[model samples]
Structures are given as C-alpha cells and as structure tokens.
Target: MGERLVADLIVERLQAWGVQRIFGYSGDGINTVLGALRRSGTPRFVQARHEENAAFMAVGHAKYTGEVGVVLSTQGPGAVHLLNGLYDAKLDSVPVVAIIGQQSRTVLGSAYMQEVDLLNLTRDVASSFRQQVNSPEQLPLVLDRAFKAALADRAPAVVIIPHDIQQAPAPELEQEHGVLTTAPVWSPPTLVPAPADLERAAALINDGGKVALLVGQGARGARGQVRELAEKIGAGITTSLMGKPYVDESHPLAAGVMGHLGTSASGFVLGECDTLVIIGSNDPWTEFYPPPGAARAVQIDIDAAAIGNRYPVEAAVTGDAAATLEALLPLLEPRPESAWRTSVEEAVQRWHRLAAERAATPARPVNPELAVRELSDRLPSNAQVAVDVGSIVYWYARQLRLPEGVPAHLSSTLASMGCSIPYGLAAKLADPARPVVALTGDGAMQMAGLSELITVSRLWPRWTDPRFVVLVLHNNELAEVTWEQREMEGDPRFDQSQALPDFSFARYAELLGLQGILVDDPAKIGAAWNAALDADRPVLIEVLADPDVPLLPPFPAGEEKGGTMMDALRKEGRDTQHARDLLETYLRQEEGLNRGL
Candidate 1:
C-alpha cells in the first residue's frame, strides 16, 4: 500500500484522537510538521515563546479537557527545555503527547545542528519514547502506539519525527485504525487483602476508642468510598495536602488537612486517636506522623512499597483504596454506637468555630487567611483553582474548601514555584466555559512566563475581557520556609533581606490589557475579588502582605531540608534553632486559639 508523509500521518492520527490544539514552539527542523499542519489544517496550532511553557500549557489543557494535550518542539535544546514540564505532567498524571523534530535520519550520530539524543533525555519523564521515524510507512503505527502508551499509563509520551521523514510523501491517508480511536483500558493491579490483614485491621477498629482516617492523592476516584469507610469505622477524617479534594470539608467527620499548615483540630485528633488508618496516602514528610504510643495502625495502598514505608503498620493491605475499602466493608463487624465518634466530631466543630472567630477580626491590612476563606466561599461551585507554591499554598491547603465533585490541580510532587499562572491558563484552555482562578504569590508569578498571558489572552479573548482573575499574594518576598533555619541559627540576616521590591503587579497586568486591582485592606479583599470575577476580561488582584509573617511549623518530623539553602543552613548550626523557634511560635498561637482567648 502507498503511504502518506510522516507528518501528515501524525496529524491525521491526532485528529482521529480528537486533539484540537497543539501548543508548541516553532523551529526549522519541525517546520515540515508545521507545513503539514498548515496543509492538512486539522488540529490548530497555538505557538508559545518557550517550549517549556508550551508543555505546561498543554498539561493544563489535558487536565481540564480530558483529551490528550499535544506539545511540539525541535530537538536538542528545545527538547531539553521541555523536560521539566514533561516531568511535571508525568508526576501529576496529566496525559500529554510531545512531538520533537529531530535532525535528518542521515545524520543520526553526526552531530548535526540541533541534534541531540532526545530519546535518552525523555525516557525518565515519558511513559514511552519513540525514536525518529525513518520511513513514512511507519508513521501511523508509531502515532497509534504513542497515544495508547500516554493514555494507558496516565502520563506523558514522546514521539520523535525526523526532519527528512516528515518531508517525504507518497499517498493519501488510510482508513482510521480501530486501535487509534479507542481509549486505553486500565485495570487496577489486582490485590486481595490477606485474611489475617483484614481481621487484624477490623479488630483494631473495633477495639480502639478513638480513630483517625487520613487520605491522599491516590484516593482521587475513591472519595465516596473513603467517606463511607470513615463513617462505618467511626473515624475522624483528614487529608494530605494533595488530598484536599477527596472529601468535602462540610462533612461532620472532616478535620481539615493534617500537615505543617494543618488545623488545630488535626493535631488534637491525630494526637488523641487510638488508631490511625492511612488510606492511599504515601506522604511521610508531614502527613503521616503517628501519635506517641497510639493504639495501632492500618495502611491500604495500591503501591506495595508504600504500605509500611512511613509508620509501622500493624496491618498492611496492598490493594486499591476504593476496591480494598469495599472489600473490607463486608468483613468489618459493626461496633456499638459509642462516644468515640461524637468526641472527634465535637473537636472538629470546636476548631471550625475558633477559625471562624479568628477570621472575624478586621485587621488593618487584610488577613491572608481571611482572604483565602472569602475566595473559597465566593467562587462558583465548579470553578477550577490552580495554586502556586509558597506560603500561600499552605493557606489554600488548610482553608480553601471546594464544592464536592469539583477537580483541583496543583504541583504536589515537584512542588515547583511559578506553576500557578501557567496552570490557570491551561485550566481555562481546557474548559473555557468553566471559571478559572489562579492563587499565586508575587515572587513566584514574577518568575513565570508572563508572555504566556498574551497567549492566553489571544486564545481566550474573554480572559482579557475582565471576568478572569489571578489572585496575587503580594508578600513582597520569596518567603521561603528556610527563614526559620536562618532564625534558629541566631542569624539576624534571615528576616528582612529576603524581601523583594514592591513592584506593581497589577499595573503589569493592566499593561497586558487585563484589569488590575491592588488590595491593601482586609475589608476590601472581598469587594476586589467580586469585582475581578465580575469583569468581562481577565483581572489581576495584587494583595500586599507582610513578608515577615512566619509559615506554620513542620510536623513532628520537622521541615524537609531538600534544597541547597536548607543544606547550607544545616551546616551552620542554624537548622535546629530555626525549626525550634518556628515550632514554638506555632504551638503557642495554636494553643491560644484553642483556648478561646
């Protein structure tokens, strides 16, 4: 059979898979594919200034649209630029297909211009990587396989199209292959609980006078099942930072998140619980601190490695959260209605009341916490929220409550800064009809590709019209968690030097043809938020915050010293002191709040 050009064949396959937009950067090597796109005129191309931003935008699109987001780049540096974004997509489980235009097949190892080993570089970030195509005939099969791998693994996949092959042409497109249009089948790894594991876990639940249930990102599709398990087990439920969307906060058993910025109730319940059942949560850094001398522990997870990775588990059930919970339901003998459930519920309510009381204070500058609460309350039920990394993330994680069934996206694994703006744009692109809000810190937003706002404006004119809102927490500094490290070391330099100049972020937004509002007063935050959301175009609400405010203390395990600054601080004898002071202040405030003073 005669064959179509590789570029044409790829575009045809993408169209068949329902791809509507290709977010990418143009280059000489990929011009062949671009020409093919121009001629075939199927999937529309949305050009980005940088390949990394293009990949990020595609990730946003995929998350919101539930379609395979496509990003194109030239080989070598261009392909390398996409690595971070690709890794983000992979870790976050966003389905994306990246196509790189490689040097001609003739120069495979000749060090031709823009030639680099893309396949090797992309292997770790991509679920599957295909080398450059040498023949037009192989195009259809390769494209088909790429899509399947991307969707099946729930990750990003890369396909390399050689420049020479993309230019070669022979025949018209063939009939659509059945495999090309079908969704990949996903079967959760089958794991049945051991008879002993179930019995032991059930016994722990029955005997414990107080229990707590903690959920994580792995519980995405199993929220209802988790809630049912919590109710049946008579346990107070809390979530890891990444698991906030799993259960509605309105649930009586919900005790907010349990971590660094976790509520006072979380600490109380976590400390007091006789048993802790960790469900699909692998976060040991902050979320899984076992209480001192607790009754026992049960862990359920799909990944066997995570079963006992953190705390010592008396019972480890290696199975999917929802499926395992369903199975365990029948095995659990009903317990008598006891005071344990009521006690936890009362504690949670008390904490909620205290939080409400604290928020009622009308401070001069708007309290950041109150702003977060107001935004959480005002946004539409289905509004999509994309949060940047910083102290602001802590606030959102602890306070913001999304309506049930609404999806929220964040960079949980990498926890990279500057992800909010791109994520928001991507969310808007993914579902143009759904209102999208970006909660970003000023420092982080400055580091992001501001030019992408132009792309977003061009793509969705309404975003520039005033209805879109980007809430900037203008703390005027990096506000890194490491300040405590500096303080503990008795270094006076830690506090103010880290701050940034008070530039006009709102003005910058205005220059980009979006409405801009500067919020300095606590009482005016709600009005500003409402006005921004009411606008017909995109709006930037730059909120000025005190940079000196400390982040909440780390959990019992202490702050994670992962990066360079943290390592440096550790060497200077500054680490432990900073952690101690931060923890002390946090505990004091928490105690005061709990006392109803």
Candidate 2:
C-alpha cells in the first residue's frame, strides 16, 4: 500500500466511524486537518463562527441523535473556547469527541505563535478521556480509543494532534489495500436490575396507598413504560427538567416538572405519596428529593452510583428504565384511588386552570407567560423548541406544554445562558424538516446568542429545508435571578448587572438580512411568531415584557420568612407589590376547585 498523509487517514477514519459532519473553525494549527477533510470528501466540515458555538452544536447534535457528536478546532484559544460546551456535555452525560490542532513538533517547548498547553487547559472538564497523538503510527489507535471512550462513558473526549504529525506519512496495516482499520463496532451494553431489587420495589408499590413517579432523561426511551406504571398504580408523574419532554404532557398522570422551575402540583404529588418510585433523575434540588421518612422510595437508574444519592431508598434497581420497569411490573398490583392521590389530581387540575388564567392576562408591557402560552398553542405540529436558561426557562417550562412529537432541547444541566440559538441550529441539523424555535431571555440573548445570529445569517443561504425562529423574552432584566437574590440572601438591592439594557435583537436580525420583528404589545407577540415560522429566511422575534413580573418556581425555595422578597424590592426602589400576586390566582383557582367549581 502507498504511504498516505496522516491527515487523510484521520478524516477517512472519521468517515468510517459514521461521522457525517464536523463542526469547527479552521486555523493555522489545524490547516492540515481541514485540507485532509477536503481531500477525503466524506465527512463535511461545517465552519462555525465561534469555536464555542461549534462545540455546542456538537453537543446538541449528540443529544438529539443519540450519536457521538464530533467537533474540531485549532490549538490555544480555539481549544479553550470548546471548554464551555464540552463542560455542558460533561455535566449532561452526552457523548462527544473533540479533535484539537497543535503546533509542529519542533515548537513543542518554545512559546510559539499559537502554543498553549492543551492538556492542562482541558483536563478538568473532559474527564472521560484526554490524549494527544505524538506519532503517525499512533494516530489510528489514539482516535479509536477516544471515540470508544466517549461512547462507553457518555462523556466528552479530547484528542490533540500536532500539524507535523498530521502531515507525516502513515504506515500501511494488515487490512485490504493496506488501509489501517480505524473504528471497531462499539455499543453500550443494556443493563437489567437483579430480581431481588425488582421484587422489593414491587412489594413497596403494592403496599403503599399513594405512589408517585419521578423521571429524568434516562427515562426518554421508556416513556411508554413510565406512563404504564403510573397509570396502573394510579400514581402521579413528576419530571426533572431534562425529562420534561419524555412523557406526553397530555398524559393522564403527568404532573409536570419538579425542583427549581417545577410546578406546585408535582410537589404535592411527591409530598403526599407513600411509595415514591424515582427513575432516571438525580436532580439535586432538595425540595424535589423524596421527603425523608414519609415514604418508602424505590429508585431505578442506569447509573448505579445515583440510586440512593438524592434520597433514602428501600429498593435500588440498577438497570435501564424500560428493562427495570418491565421486571417490576409483573410483581405489582393495580392501586385503588386514595384521598392523597385524589387530592393531587385535583391540585393538578386547578394548577392548569390557574396557569391558563395567568397566561391569558393581558399585560400593560406584555406578559412573558402569555407569550410562551401562545407559542405553545400555535407551534406547528413539527416545531422543535430550544430554551435558554434564566427566568425565561420558568415561562417556557411552565407555559409551553409540547405536543407528542415536538421536542424541546434545553441547557438545563449546565444551566447556561446563550444556548438556545446554537441549540436550534444543531436541532435543525439533526432534523432538517422540522421548524426550529429558540427561546431566550434578554440577558441570555446578549451573552452569546447574538454572535450565533451571524452564524445563522451565514448558513441561511446554504439550506432551505427546515426553517428557523429566534424568540427573545425581552424584559431588560434577569427576572428569575433578581427574585432569587432578594428571596435567598435578603439582599437590599439587586446588582446592576441583573438589569440588562434594552436592545433590539430583532433589528440586529434585520441588519444581517434576516426577517426581524420587535413586538412590545401582547397581541403582536403571537402574530410575530406566526409570521416568522412561514418566512423563507431565519427570523428573530423580540417580545418585550414587564420586568417587574415575579418569576416564581413550583414552590418557595426559601426557609426564611416572607419579609425577604418584599423588603428587597422596597430597598431596590423597584415595585414593592405583594408576593401573593404570583400565586393569588392559583390560590383562588384552588379554592374554587374545593367548592366544586
């Protein structure tokens, strides 16, 4: 076999590994890699505006497709930029591989133009694997190891290759045409819990009067089983933020989210249950954790380490959610309706009614909840939502009840800002036929999403299949965090950083040759979104809302008295309105339900 450039080998191996796209920015350090990509003509290189966005794109791709997301970048700043998104994948347990470029071997010790110690910069975040290829002969083995580690650990892996090494001659191997074998067949093994754990869990479920189910992303493929178990036991279902989209919102037992941005009805379900069946989720929020001593908890998870970490457990089943539930279901019997279960159901119903009332209320400066509700109701059948973190997450999570097929990709685990725009782009890349919508708060949009807007502009002309929409929840403040600082720290005044200066992100969208609409009126918000969905090019809709509106979680996250919230507002010279306003409508609806209204 003829000698081949190591660069060509790398790209060819990537193609053999089923990588269809490589998200990255080319630089002097990585020139050889990009050159090889062009020669191979198998894996397409998508040039991202920023290295960070490229990493996030890979993260989003891996998340939506359940495949290893691949990203590439030059050394130094480029490699450093990938950290944020890599950490995102790390914390979220998504599989991703990062290929970083390095200087020539000659400049290994010198402070060359682009030299920065890559290993030291990335070691903490890319915990699964981190290795640099030193020789041409080592390329295949190194690349293969990184790829396999990503799949096995469901975490990020980094590989750094020097330009000289990439350009070196590669040795022929034993395979046909002396083409060295790159990736071997790799797959994660399916796990099943032991019989004793299943039997113990089933026994607990059978003896308890009230049962509640808590689910997370690990329960994604087990939606049917989760729903079935809940229905059989007459149990209420509560989801961690990541699991919000797994179950259909219209399911009879669905009680919505738990923890920070969760729903009160879901909290009530957990508090009232005697047997709590927690599956998949390891959310650290104590408010959502199974209350100690009140219930016998049975947890099912693929990761054995998470079984009893969040709450005390009587039965901890270590297996896939679907397989574990299948083993336990036969041992359990149907549960009759009880007062606690009935109370939770009624609470859920009332909660929905109250949410609707709040969503319908017309705002003097526009209402975020109303905007989100309109979005939820009017989204096209195949629309995909990607919501950024901060106050807007509450609005999107609570008001937007996605239909059966629609998926909402979120930055929930990392809880990072500026993720929605890039996430929407990656979501579109995964499924080019669906309408992609990105929801962002004022602060989040300005943080990093604005640059992604430019990336959108650049990519708009290249494809026309799936459309894109960016919805900005414009409030000129971090509404949720503002409320939190006051309530948690008893702070007298909010940091000036909380209030974001007003910016017309829509106008910026127009400057980039895309459709942009700024709507301050409540009536225009829905119309703007509808128009954006039908537009040929990407569109940005900036809907202004009142900054004074309180962003409340499912329940109060504080242990102190009520004085903290009101007092802080007064000190800040902001609206000193009643905190009751946040829940007044809900309480009213609950009372009406009690009276059989």
Candidate 3:
C-alpha cells in the first residue's frame, strides 16, 4: 500500500498475461514476491508439498490447458528441486516458465547461505531462455521474454531474481533510454508446406500399397484431419505415447500406441507398412519404425529440425500439422478399400481379443491389467486423465480405451515417475467441474503421490465438483525396472534395489479425510471405480495387484527377447514359477497371433 515494489510489478505482469494461478512453496528468498502475490490477490497462489511437485504441477497445467505454466521457488535447494519437472517440460516439449529467487545482491560471490549459481544450474534444462533479473527496470523485459520463449519453443524458460531486486521499488517507464517495456503478446502462426512439397508428399502416399501414419502430440489439434487423411489413403494409424489422446482409439484403423509399451496391433501395422507418414511426432523409438529401407517415409513437423531427427525422411514438410494436413488433403487421391485395409482391421481385432484375454487372466489376487481395464468402461466422457511412469503405463496404454476428447497426459519423453498426482492436481485446478482420474504405481505413489494427497485433502472441498480419483496399483515392487533388468541385462530382480516397503495407501487416504477403497478382488475393481467417480470428495482406490504379471514388449520384439527373460527368471532360484508361467502365456499368445490362428 505504501509503494509498488518490484515483486508487485512482477505479479501484475503475470496477471496481464492471464495467469490465474501460481504453484510454489513459500521460502525466505521468495518471501517478498509471495507477499506481493498475497497483497494483489488477483493471481491465486497454490501451495504445493514440495518444490519438485510444484514444478510438475506447472508442467501439467501447461500440458492440459495449452497455456504457459508458471512456477516459483527459492534459492539453492528449492531451485535444485525444480530440475526434474523442468526437464520433464523440456523433454516433452511443454511450455513452462520458472521464476526462481536468488540471494541478496550484496552477497555477491561470497557464497552466502542458500546462494547457489542458479543460472549455471539451469543451463541445460532452460537452454531455450535463461536470465538473471539484475534491476527493476529489466523485470518486464525478462518476464515477457520468458513467456514468449516458452510459448514459441514449447520449452521451459527461467528467470532468476535476487532478493534485493525483488524488494526494490518498481521503475517508471517514461521514454527511458536504458529501459525497455515489453507486453506479453504472442499469436499462433498458420504453417503449411508449399504446393510442391505437398504434391510430392501426396504422390508418395498414393504410390504406396500399404500406408501407415505415426502421430505425435503436436498433431493433437489435427485429429479430424488425421482421421480424414487415414480414410482417404486407407491407412492404419499408430500414435506415439504422447499422441495417444489425440486420436480415437476406437477407430477400426487405429492400431494403438507404438513402441515397447505399445500394442501388438501397432507392431503389426508398423512392420507391414510400405509407406510411413510421420506427423508432428518425434517419438524416440526409431527401432520400432519400419526397418531402415523397408518403408519410404515423409515427415511433417512444425519444427524443421525435428523432421529427420528420428527416422530418415524422403519428404520433409516443415509446417504445422493441422494446417499442413488440411492443405495436403486436397492433393491426395482417395484409395479404394483394399486387402491391406482388411489386414490392418484384422490385426486390430486380434489385439482387442489378446488384450481382453490378458486382462481377464487369473492372478494371485488382482491382475493389474484388469484394474486399469475396468476404468475404461467407467471413465466419464468429461474426465481428464493423468498417468504415471512404470508398469502402470503399459496397462494404461494397452487396456484403457480413452473416449475421444478426453485428454490423458504423462511424462512420456522423460519417463519420470512421481508425476501423476501433481499432473492430476493441475488438471483438476484448471477446471474443477471436470472430473480427473490419475493412475500411478506404488513406487511413484511412495515417492511423491502420498505427499500431494495432503494437498488434495486441503483443496478438494473448494472444488465445484469433487470427483478427483487416484488409482494406486499396489504391487509392492518396482515392476517396470524389475522386468527391465531381466530383459535387458538377463539378470534376476535384486531384492535390495527392486523391492518396495509395504504401505497402506488406502488407509492413508482415509486418514486425510478422503474416501478410500481397498480392493484385492478383481470383481470389485469396477465397483471401486464407480464409487470413486461418484464420491462426494476426492477418493483413492488402492488395488492389490500381482507383481508376477510380465511387462513384456509387444510381439516380434517381445518374442525375440523371451529367451533372455526366461534365463533371468530361472536364475531367480525359487518362487518365480508364476512369473515364468505368465511369460510363457504371453509368448504363446504372440505365437498364435503370428500363425493367424
């Protein structure tokens, strides 16, 4: 009230950019900025359990809402804690702006308490744009540039402000010589390839007898165009994990996600296709793509550099996916329904049967596949989903059928664990009217999900519709990495490193004043989902999943790796018979698929 400080100006600028909320934890270095945010009361501040979780929430907000997410933190440890989430944004190509606090200017190179070199620390994660705010006059330019860079590059940007600068008086811009005032202004550009490039791409597509499309997150806006393109060319579509939400999995030609965590149907489509069209996806699994010269590829991406990064491309169309596809559709000659289309559809049906069989298979208590598959039917049409890393991702990818327009996001490129709860929190905060479902494994829940549940307990009552449901697959093991060691290293699961301590996830949820349902029976899985969705408050459904379920890759690749896995299991010495049997079951299923039985 006395005079506007630099912190006040910073908050005002954020509001001008239409930021409704800022996620962070309070710290001494950032106390002044926190005070300004409290005083203005325009941009609400959501306190997170940890700086890492707060950063994940920021990334989640950007992913779900298509807006620039903002996060704040104090010096040293708080800043270091933000690295994982910031890297998640960087690897997944999300827009996030991190505003970090530094020690007072007087501390200089004295290495004062909590005074760390944040600029150097964040060099790689925020390589798109990183700067230290030295003066009040430079604050506006830095803030505006950070937002612009984040939006433009679809990456995280950093702005480090010293404690002294945050407390300084706001500067007045009156035709100043050494000061620059920047407004937060940006607009999406309409990018389409030239007519010649479009013609070439279309000609290549028309020439191929068997065509396939590999879609990624960047093609999210062009779902209709993608479907139309596939229909016109009689093509099968397989999505990168990040692109799964954009395409309708219910489509007959939809082959499901492509990669190790992908479906057998996707493996079939990618393996058989003669022409590959990569759209807006720079998926890292190049080995899963049509082998070397087996297919002629055309890549479409907004970022030109990413076009040929993953696979060799014959036609590199540097343009926005929706705009490029819209233009190219006119040039494409529709192909009549052919035998190739029939084969693709047949593969898809086979995968459906295989998945259902796997999900229904009996386990000691509950099959993790069944736990996730049950949610596919009960998931509301208006729900938003957040998936965590680990074995749970495999079930979510294979068993869950997301209705069109229901966005499901995760740490795909980074493959970072401990992200689901924070991501769900961000999605819920954006539009509390829409219910959110978060799926996580016990390993991730132990790392960060449990702490964030307390945040949910404190905030859920304020939501308009309290239908935030958390699904914890309590397998009591790091199942994904356990299988990784067997398949990759041909080594048994080491109890010292792979086993997790026992914890009561559901009871803990109840202690926090939320509804908790513990299900060890497969029959109760559907009912648990129903109750959670219908609950008046946030609910956590903990399922006692079996660790013996194999995390096998999709066939041919999976079948080839079977011998190595069998060797590792045999080395487990004892009590691994169930796991070996499960592995044999999956191998037989793949063999049947190969024989067309």
Candidate that would win on lDDT: 3
RMSD each, Å = 5.1, 2.9, 0.8
lDDT of each: 0.73, 0.81, 0.94
Question: Positional deviation of 44 in candidate 2, in angstroms?
Answer: 1.5
Regions of model 2 farther than 4 Å from truth:
1-3, 174-182, 464-466, 556-562, 574-597
State the lDDT of candidate 2 residue by residue for 349-393, as single tens digits: 866876787777655578788888887777888877888988788
TM-score of each: 0.85, 0.94, 0.99
* TM-score, ranked from best to worst: 3, 2, 1
lDDT of 1 at 64: 61
**What order do you get sorting by lDDT, best first?**
3, 2, 1
User: What residue runs in model 1 are displaced by over 4 Å at the alpha carbon?
Assistant: 1-3, 65-67, 127-130, 170-204, 284-288, 291-295, 302-306, 314-320, 335-337, 357-364, 462-466, 481-484, 487-497, 554-587, 594-597
Per-residue lDDT for 468-578 in model 3, tens only?
A: 999999988999999999999999999999899999999999999999999999999999998999999999999999988998888889998888999999999668999
